[model samples]
Target: MTDGDLDATDPRTLPGFFDALADGKLLGGVCTDCGQVLLPPRPACYACGSRAVDVEPQSREGTVFSYTEVHTPPPAFAADAPYTVAVVELADGGRLLGRVAADYSDVAIGDSVELTVHEPTAAEREVALDYETDWPVHIFEPR
Candidate 1:
């Protein structure tokens, strides 16, 4: 199956994340009880085991917690190899994992960044989060 051909409605599918993306927003789950934040959010909190989770709009602004340059990506991401992957700590105390953008040579731990979504190309026009153009890819740019 192609990247865009995968089923996106199922929570088990990454495309389900795109459902939020299509609306030009990014979503993360927050525990209703303890207020712990989750990225690539879950229906239940890993911390307090609460099923009363609520969707939260993540802050686009964050600081780089850590990063690494991957010379080799998985088969699916091979085309975007030699990329920087980062763990960013959002201002609201959440974290997100994603690519750091092409011009990221000067990045360092604790650098400030803001999120921006990128639309998929026509060739990748599937109804998944990876294919949503209307939804911006939550990429980090220097702040």
Candidate 2:
């Protein structure tokens, strides 16, 4: 998708992004100006402040850039305290933050991982806003 098609109804939007994710496709925005990749396909590039972002498929493969264990989670995630989370640098150049499917003890910086998507659990849906209730949740799995 090109910049001209980036509206509230396209993959650059949350609903459209989740829709594609639910179908197991990962899409990101490639900056025409500086080649920065934006997860969830935003209309503008955060790196160059350009409006030349183009939506494209992205690789699910990545490596952990940074990680930490979440011992103190928000109320919505209280049941899942002490979970592992990380900022993964994707093979396609986009970096995204997500829950890691592995334990904190099992993951390290530079660990290979793959992104996965799943429907929100009942508990997750309980805390989601009306528009986000059906959005797919993404997690990174150690590979």
Candidate 3:
């Protein structure tokens, strides 16, 4: 699909995510009723079953919870294969999964890291997250 085809509404939609990314921010959802944090924020709380979720800014800081290096990605993301994918536990107790920009050999469980907003290049547009920024690609860097 073309960049123009990207949808920017609702966090669940790519377009909305990209809109935040273009602004260099990582947005997540929080349960207004229970104070539960949700990464990749949803409209409802998975824990308390509440629909009173609120948009909250997530901290870029986190620790590697788990990770794997994929030698092959699905057809669409084949180019990013052999890359490290990680589940990051944020400072606020939420978790998110994203690509680790660093070399897989350098990754370690529990490593400190911060969020980075990556800009979409033409080649990366297809699999680009809606949250990418116009600024430099954001990666979790060592603290």
Candidate 4:
């Protein structure tokens, strides 16, 4: 399907997100009712319960709102046992949870970051995103 056909309501919607990711594009679901934007497109508007939504393009830069270093990873991520994850505030005011593309010791809550997309190895995907993803995963590196 085409990017124009990406639907937040489809059962394959999450996979469609990967499709966009593979294309070096980031997508967010914008609620028509409450004007809220969410990453990893949800089925309905969290604010106003609107099923009417639009698939929107997202900015590539953001600031970290919160972050944590993971030292003890699960088996899937044992290969890269230590990493940093961050809650980033996207330019559109949407927050995304993603790997911080930096050493764990360097990440901070207020750091400015820009997007980097990676088509990771199976192990790296699991380590970074907690998913053995088939498409590129998003990372935020210090700007």
Predictions in order: lDDT: 0.71, 0.92, 0.74, 0.79
Pairs of colliding residues, candidate 2: none
List model 3 lDDT by residue over 60-133, tens digit each.
89999998898878886777678888898999888888888788889899999888776666666655555443
Highest lDDT: give the candidate number: 2
Badly placed stretches (over 4 Å) of model 3 are 1-14, 126-139
Clashes of each: 4, 0, 12, 0
What does candidate 2's lDDT look like per residue over 5-87, in tens digits?
A: 55556988988888999999999999989999998787888898998888899999999999999999999899999899999
Which residue pairs of candidate 1 clash?
18-129, 117-136, 117-137, 118-137
lDDT of 4 by residue, 69-137 (tens): 888988877776588899999999789988887987887778899888888776665556444356677
* CA displacement after TM-score superposition, residue 102 of candidate 3 (Å): 1.7
lDDT of 1 at 43: 64
Which tens-of-lDDT digit does each residue in 19-136 have in candidate 1? 6655656677778899998776666689988777676677778999999898876665667678888999988888888778755588899998887776764533443353444444
In terms of lDDT, model 1 sits at: 0.71
TM-score of each: 0.74, 0.94, 0.76, 0.83
Better of 1 and 4 by TM-score: 4
What's the TM for model 3? 0.76
lDDT of 3 at 5: 30
